[model samples]
Target: MAGSADTLFMPITNGEIPLGEGQWLYLGARAIDGGFPDELRAALVCEQSMRGAYLDLQMRGMNVSPRVDNTDRFSGALILIGKHRGENETMIARASNMVSAGAPILIAGDKTSGVAPLRKRIAAFAEIDGSLAKYHATVFWLRNSVDFASHFSSAKTSPQGYQTSAGMFSAEKIDKGSALLAEHLDENIRGDIADFGAGWGYLSAELLNRFSPRTVHLYEAHCASLEAAKENLSDYDKGQISYYWHDLTREAVGKKFDWIIMNPPFHEGRKTEPQLGVQFIEVAARSLKPKGGLLMVANVTLPYEKTLQQNFSKVNQLARRDGFKLLKAQL
Candidate 1:
C-alpha cells in the first residue's frame, strides 16, 4: 500500500466503490498520490508519522488533528492497514465503529502486510460485501455493524505494566540505545530540556527521575505513542511536562532549549532511512541555545557523524556497545 495507488483507489476509479454523498473517514491513510478527488469529503485519522505523508496531507489542506473529539459518526470509512498487527486490528475496529450498519468500510493492504489473515478474520464476523485484488494487494469492504465491535475494536493483550501501543519505537520494552543513553546521561542535565522523538516516555520518565528540569518537552510524531507517553508520565507535575504530537522534521520546535536528548527514528516504512536522524539533528541544532548540548543514541551503522559535526560546534562519541553508539553534540 506504500506506493501502490490501485490498492485503495482502483475501486473508486472503476466506479465499484462509491463515495458517500456526505462525509467519509480515512484511517491510517498513507500518502495518496494526489489525495482524494476534490468532490469527496474526506476526514483523516492518521496516528503514525511518516514525514513525507504528513507533508502530502498538509499540502492537500487535509491536516486534521489525529484526536477527533466525536467519533463513530462518519457515513463511510476506509482503513489502510499497516504492518503492525495490533495497530491494524485497532484501526479496523475503530473504522467499523465509525461508520453505521450497512455503511461501507473498506480495508486495504498489500500481501506482505498480513492482509489475508485480517480479511479472513473480519469476514468471519462482519458482513463481507465483496473484495478486489490488484498490485499484490487486497481491498475488501465490510458493512459496519455493532455485532462485531468487540472482536475488532482493538488487539487486547499487553504484558504487565506496558505503556505503549503497536508500531511505536521500542513499544514493547526499553530500547537498548535509549536505555544506554539514559544510563550514561550527564548528572547535571537540569535546564530546559527536550526529548526529540520521545517514544512512550521512557527517556522522559528517566529524565524526570534524575532531574527536576524547569520544563521537559516531549516531541513525538505518533499520536497513539504520544497518548501512551502521557499516561506513562501522568504522575509527574503538570508544569514540568509539555507533550507535542508533531512532525519533528517539518514543524518548528517553537522555542530553543538548554539541552536536547533523543533516540531519533531512523526508519521510513520498511527501509532504513538514516537521513531521518540527520533531519532530527538539524532540527535539534536549530532549536537549541548556542551553549546547549545534544545527547543521542543511534545504531552503530547509521551515518550520522558528518551531519552531527556539521551542525554542532563540538561533537564527541561518549560510548559504543551492544551495536549502539552514544554521542554528544554541543552548540
Candidate 2:
C-alpha cells in the first residue's frame, strides 16, 4: 500500500523545507530519489537489503546503516520516515525515542499505508506543524516532545516459542517456507555454519539443537529481528552463536563456512525480483569452502535452479510441498 518512490519524495523535490546541515537519520528509507539533501550528513536505516543497496548506490557519501534499534540514540536533528505496513507503530515509537526534544520529524507515505492514522498517533507526542498532499502521498512535519516511553517498551512473543517484534517477517508465527526448510535440514550439518537472512533465530536455534556444529553464525538485516534473535537464543551456548547486523548483498564475512542455510528475500518492496535470490546464490557460492554445502528454500516457480547450477558443481531438490521447494547444492 506504500506509494511509489517519486510520490514519497515529492515534498522534498518541491522545496517544502530545507534539509539543514547535521546528522540526519532516515528510518525505513526504501529506494527513493530527489528527497535527500546533499549538504547534510545523512545516515539511512533500512531493513531490506535490496532497497539498502539501491539507496547506497544512489546516495554517494552518505552513511548507510542497516537498521534502527533501541540502542541507536541520535538527537537534535531531522529524521525522515517512510511509512510501511506492519512497522508504522514501532517506527513512530522508535523515532520518538531516538530524536531529542524539539527535533524535527518528517513522515511521508500513501493514504493506503495508514499515514492519516500515523499522524493521529504521532500527535500525542509531537505537534504537527505543516503538511503537503501530492501524487497520492502525504508528507507531514512535527517536533518531538520526548514523552513516549509507555507506548513501546518490550518485544512481542510468539506461539513458536521465540521473541519477535513488529515488522519482522512472519512475526506472528513461523513462516511455512522456513518450517518446510527446517524439517528437511540435514542432520549431518557439522562444523561452522551460517544462516543468511535469519529471522528471530528460528532456523539457527533449530540447527544448534539438532546438530553438533562447532559454531553457528546468524546474519540478519532488521535490527529488531536481530535483537529478538539474541533474546530467543540466550539460553543456548553463547560462545557457539554469533549475531551480525548486516546487509548480505553488500557485506560479506571474511571466512568461508562449512555449510550455509538461507531463505533469501526475493522482493524489494511489494514487487518480486528473483534476482535478489540469484544474488544470494552467487554470494553463497563465493562464501563457501571447497565442497561446502548450501541448503535453501524458495518458491517453486522461482528460477533459482539455473543460478544454482551455474554457481555450484551439484544441485538437487530435497523436498517440495505447498508450492515451496527445499534445495541442496554443493561445490
Candidate 3:
C-alpha cells in the first residue's frame, strides 16, 4: 500500500459489504463521508482517491468523516482498527507509540460505545475478539493486550489540564457544558480566534487566559481531542496558538474569524443530536468575518435558539445555569 496500486478496501460506515466480491469498498465515515446515504454513491467503485475518517463535526460533535489523507502511506503493523469510543484511547495511545514490539495490535468499537467495557479491560492478555454488528460492536486485540504497558497506563485529569489515555471523551471531568462554557468567556474577545469544540483543551485555556486572541484555532475533531489539544496548546505561541485536526462540519476553513468560541456539541455520543447543534450554527455562520461573532453554549432545552436565529442574524442568551445556556451570536 505504498504510493497506491490496489488492495485498499476501507469501508465501514454502514458496514456489511463483506460477504464476497472483487472487494472494492471505500465508504468511510459512515457512507458518503458522514452525511451518508446518497444512495451509497451508487455503491461506489472506480476509486482513485477516497479518504475519510470521523468526528470533527465541529469538535467531537461528530458524525464521522476524516481518515484517508494517506499519512505517508503507512508501512507496518499498528492495528487498532475500528470502533469509535471517542477514538479508543487516542487509538491506543497512538498504537503504543507507533508499534514495534510484536506488532499486530487491534481493537474495535461501538459495543454500546464502551467496546464491552473495553473488551473487559483488554481481556487477560490479548487474542480477544467479540463480534456482533446489528448496528455496531467489535473488538480484537493482539499486541500482548494485558501487557500493553500493563492495561494502558498514563492517566491525568485535572481542573482541565491534559494527559489522558484509555479511551477519550470527558476522560474524567472538565466538561460540565464545557465548564459552563468556560465561565462565559467574552472578555470582549478580540481578533482572530476559534475554539469550536476544542474539547480537552478547556475552551482553549479559556481563550488563552481570557480573550488573548490574536490567533487561536483549536478546531479539533477528536484524535483524542486533537491529542489533548496538542498537549494543551503546548505553552502557547506557535503564532499565538494553533491546533487543527479540523472537521467543523465539512471543510471551509477559508480563514476569517473575529471570534467563534463554542460549547456547541449537544450530544452525538449519547444520541440527542440537536442536528449537531444545527451544524455548528451553520458552520459558525460560514466562518464569520462580517459581523464576526458566535459565543454559543447549549443544553437549556436545546433547540439552539431556532438554529441560532436561522444562522446568526443575531441571537442572544448570554448566561443561564445548571441546565446550561450561554449562546451569543452576530455574523
Candidate 4:
C-alpha cells in the first residue's frame, strides 16, 4: 500500500519535530502544501515528474529545490519512506552517507509502507532518538553516523547483462509489453529517435542494437533508472546516445525527432492516471517532426486511441496481446 502525504507529514503537523533552519533535504516528498514549515532552506528530492505540482508550489512562493540527491549533502534530511524495500534502504543508506556525522535525519511513513521494519534497519547505522504514532503512521528521528555505502553496492545485473537497480520499473526482467514492442520494431528505423519514459534503456538498447539509429535520445524521470541506463548502454557509441533526467509533462526536449518510441507509463504511483499517458502522447506529437512517426505500447484498457487520433494524422494498431496494445502513429 502507498502512504498518503498527510500521513507522511503528521509528525511535523503535530509539532513533534520542527523543520529547523539551515539546509534541509527532503526525499520522496511528492506533495507540499501549507502543512510544510516556511523557515527552512528546503530541497525536495523526487525522481518522478513533478512539473505540474511543482509549478503550483513555485507560484505559491515556496522556496524548495525541485530536485536533490545524496550528492547535495544537506545538514538534515526529511525522508518519507516509499513502498519499495530496496528503494527505502538505498535512500536511507545514501542519506546516512551524505549528512554530517552528527546531523539529524527524520523518516516517516504509514504502517502499510513498513515503517516499523525500516526503523529497525536504520538502527544498524544510527540510533533512533524518538518516534511518534498518529494517523496510522509512524515518524522517527535519528542522528546520522556510520558509512553505509557498502549497503548500496553496484546495481544488480540480469542474465542478459542489463544493469538494473531495485525499485525501477520492470527491474527484475524485461517487461513483456516492452518485449512485444521490440519484436515489432522495424530494423530499418533510422534517424534521430527518442524514447520517453525509457526504463533502464531496454528499448533504447534494442533500438541501438537492431536499427543503429544515428542518434537516440532517452528521457527518464527516475534518477536511479537513468543511472542504470547509463551503465547498461555504455558499450554503444557514446556520441550516438544521449540521456536526460526529464519530466515530459511540463518540459520539452527543445528539438524535434525523426522517430519516437515509448512504453509510456499509465500510473502515477499506485493510481491509474491515463491522462499522464495522454500527456506523453501530446509531448510526442509536438516533439516529432512534421513527417516523424511514433511507436508506442500501452495497456489495453487505457483510453489512448482518441488522444492518438487527435494528435496524429494516422493511427494504426500494430499488435495486441497479453492485455497490451502497440500503436503506430504518424504526423
Candidate 5:
C-alpha cells in the first residue's frame, strides 16, 4: 500500500489487490512512474493520501506494471484510482467493475484523449468531480453503485467498429493517421502483416480488405486497446486474424513478420517522447524477415528518418505532405 509520503506505487505486471483500510485512497493506472502529476509526490503527503492503490492492466512489454512480491489489501474504504491506458477502450470497463463492487473511484489523464468525457461517462454510476493540473486533470468519484461493463459496451466507433471506453484517444471518430494509412495502403501489402501499436484494429481492417493478408497480427501494449482491438477485429472472418494484447517491444520472443505498418505514438500522454517512435522503428527492423518491408507514417517534425536509416538498409520516402511523412524501409 502507498502512504501519503510515497509518491507512486512500486510496480506489478497484470494483477489485482485486495482493498485495504483508509479514509482517502488513490488508485493509479498501470505502473507508478508513467502516470502521475509532478504534484503527485506532494499530494501523497497527507494522512488521507495514505489510502491508495494501482491497477496495472497492461498485457505486456514496456508498460508492464512492476511486479511486487506482496500486495497490500484495501479493507473497503474511499479509494481513488487513476486511469490512463494509452488509447485503450476498456479502462472504463475496469473502473466500472471496481466502482460497482464498492470502490470509490478517482480518474486522471490527458484531456486531448477524452478524459473529460470519461469522467462524464463514469459519472453515470457515481458522484464524480474533476480538477485541473498542469498536464492532465484528476477526476474523483464516491458512489453507491456502478455498471462497469455496460458503460463501455454500448458505444462503438467505426474505423474498425470497436466498443470504446471513454478515455481512449480518437474515440469520437476515425483516427486521422488511420484514415490516412487506410487511404494509401496498396493491394500488394499481402503476406503475414503486423500493426505495431495497432490500436483497435483500425488500420488492420483496411489492410485486411485491401491485401487479404494470410495473417494480420495486431499488437498493442495496453489491455484496453488490446480488448478493443480484439472486439473490432472479431467482426472479421476467424482464423485469418490474430490479436496479441502484449507489448510489441517485448512480444513473444523470436516472432518474425513479413510486413509491419505503424503510426507509432511519439508522445506518452502529454510528454513529447520521441523515443517511442524510435523504439517502434527498431522493433520493426528486428521483427521483419530479410527483404521484408516496414511502412510508417508520422508527423514530419518527428526525426524518424535517422532511426529508420539506422535500422534498415533501404529507407525511402514514400509520401510527404500535410505535415505528415510516409516512409518505407526494407531489410
Candidate 6:
C-alpha cells in the first residue's frame, strides 16, 4: 500500500465494518491477500496515485484508477491511510464528495501512519461508527455527515515560487538538500537535462529560471506530484519541458540527457531502502550521453558513493554542507 495488508481488511474479516452494496471508493488501494471479501473487492473503484501500486492492482484484476472520477456514485468508501496527514485528509475529503451523508467511510492504518490522532481529528468533523485494533493497526468506520467537506485546501504555493500539493515531499517548504542543490547547480550546466524523481517541479522550476536548457525531462512516480509538477512548470512547458509519470526504478527513460540532476528519495514507508537510490544512479548512468554528467544531492550518510563510483568513470564531491553532500559524476 505485503507489508501494508496483511494489516486494512481486518475489520471486514471481523464484522465491525459493514460496506455498502454499490460501487465503493477505495483511496490508496493496493493488493491484499487472504480473506478480502470478494463482494467488496468487486464493488471497489480503487484509486492509487503511485504507478507501481496502480499497476499491481491492475495485474491482480482489481478495478483501479490513478485518480477518482466525480461522476461515480459510491455507497461507501474504504481508505488506507499513508504517512502524510494532509494527504489522508485529502483522501477523506474526496471520499466525502463521492458518497452522501450517512454513507460509511472505513479508514485503516498503522500507528506509525498516525491513525490514532487522525481518528480524533475526523471525529471533530463527522461521527464514528465503530473501531478495532489489530496487527499494530487501527480500523475505524465513520458516517459521513459532513458530506460537503468544506474547502479543505491541500494545495499551497511555497516560498520557492512553485505550486505543491499535499503528499509530495517537502510540499510546504523547500527541502534543505534540494535548496542546497538548487543553489549549487553547476553554472556550466546547459543543454538537455533530466530531473529524476522530480516532486512538484521544484528543482525543475529552479533549473528553468536560473539557466536556459534546451529541454528538461521530469520523471516522477506519484501521479499527484506529477500533476502538480505539470501545473507548477506550466510556463516552461511550451517546448522546454516534458513530464513522465513513471516508476524510474523499474523503467528507464527513453532519451539520454547532457546532464541529470536529482535529490533521490531513500525512504520507502518507514524503512530506509538504499537500493532505490542505487537504482536511480544506475538509471542516470545509462540515460546520460557518453560524455554527459550527473549532479545530485543526498544525506551525507547515504551509501551512494560506491554506486556512483561503480557506474560512472569519474566521481567527485562537489560540496558538503548542512548534513548533505553534492556529487558530480561523469561517464
What lDDT is reached at residue 223 by model 5? Answer: 54
The residue-by-residue lDDT of candidate 6 on 1-331, one tens digit each, is 2434545666665666666467888899977865346786688888999988888888777888889885766888889999987888888888888886678888889879999988887777666878887777888887877743463444565656667777889988988899888988756788899999998888898888788888899999998899999888888777879889899988768899999999999999888888889999999999999899999999999989999999999999988889999999999
Residue-level lDDT of model 3, residues 128-238, one tens digit each, is: 532333234443434422345446644555453565543345666666777777777766788888877676677777678665777887776665556666776677656
Better of 4 and 5 by lDDT: 4
Candidate 6 Cα misplacement greater than 4 A, ranges: 1-7, 34-38, 147-157
Give the lowest summed-lDDT range of ten residues in model 5: 45-54
Best-to-worst TM-score order? 6, 1, 4, 2, 5, 3
Predictions ranked by lDDT, top down? 6, 1, 4, 2, 5, 3
In model 6, pairs of residues that clash are none
Q: TM-score per candidate, in order?
A: 0.87, 0.76, 0.29, 0.80, 0.64, 0.92
Candidate 4 has an lDDT of 0.77
Score candidate 2 by lDDT. 0.72
Q: For model 3, what is the alpha-carbon lDDT of residue 57?
A: 26
Give the runs in model 4 whose Cα sits over 4 Å from its true position. Answer: 1-15, 18-22, 42-75, 100-103, 110-112, 116-129, 133-137, 143-159
TM-score of 5: 0.64
Candidate with best TM-score: 6
For model 2, name the residue pairs that clash: none
What's the distance in Å from true for residue 292, model 3? 3.1
CA lDDT for candidate 3: 0.56
**Where does model 3 exceed 4 Å of error?**
1-111, 115-192, 200-227, 230-232, 235-257, 261-268, 275-290, 294-306, 314-331
For residues 193-251, could you state the per-residue lDDT of candidate 5 as single tens digits? 98988776778877875667888888776555667777776767569787765655444
Candidate 6 yields a Cα-based lDDT of 0.84
Instruction: Quote model 3's TM-score.
Output: 0.29
